[model samples]
Target: DAGVTQSPTHLIKTRGQQVTLRCSPKSGHDTVSWYQQALGQGPQFIFQYYEEEERQRGNFPDRFSGHQFPNYSSELNVNALLLGDSALYLCASSLANPIYGYTFGSGTRLTVV
Candidate 1:
């Protein structure tokens, strides 16, 4: 009965550096999605993962990458981080299709100094 879990809770990175955030999906869920939420802004979908593959992506640059493991856990990797990359990174998980429902983690607050 575990819900989605995100690591570090908070993070701080320097511009031009790289960092990776992790997420463990809720039980009974097979899909994972990543989102970025800037201060005062709604979450913006970054990408979706299903069956260990990237099923869909949003309007983000190549600097963003991700991975889904056989265990259904996922990771979000940001390279050459910029100040704009600082935000709350959320991880949501659902069934095969998220149109039904999903659960979100508290997210990892990232700050690019």
Candidate 2:
């Protein structure tokens, strides 16, 4: 089965502009988790969606939000973005029961000017 995949391997935006990144989860998976991995740092959990509802969240502002589609894919949206928001946005997928670990996509590198 195809693992998770993200679009626009890289992105560039201004400090106050917004951006939207997309993701497709692996087969047989219904949960999608978004993560932010800054340079030289571990991926930080942004939020997770299961059954189209947010099941978990991390320490991030409202500027960071997401949505899960019925097809089990997802999108992360950042509003009023700041320079600090620039980072590698990753999407990970796992089983609902989560007996196994998550599978991550290569990620979309975002740079803010």
> What C-alpha lDDT do the candidate models reach, one value each?
0.97, 0.94
Task: Give one digit per residue, the lDDT tens place, for model 2 in 1-113.
Answer: 79999987999999889999999999998999999999999999999999999998999999999999999999999998898998999999999888889999999999998
The C-alpha local distance difference test score for the whole of candidate 1 amounts to: 0.97
The TM-scores of all predictions, comma-separated, are: 0.97, 0.97
Model 1, which residues run further than 4 Å from truth?
none
Candidate 1, after superposition: displacement of residue 38 in Å?
A: 0.3
Alpha carbon RMSD to native, model 1: 0.8
Q: Any residue pairs clashing in model 2, and if so which?
A: none
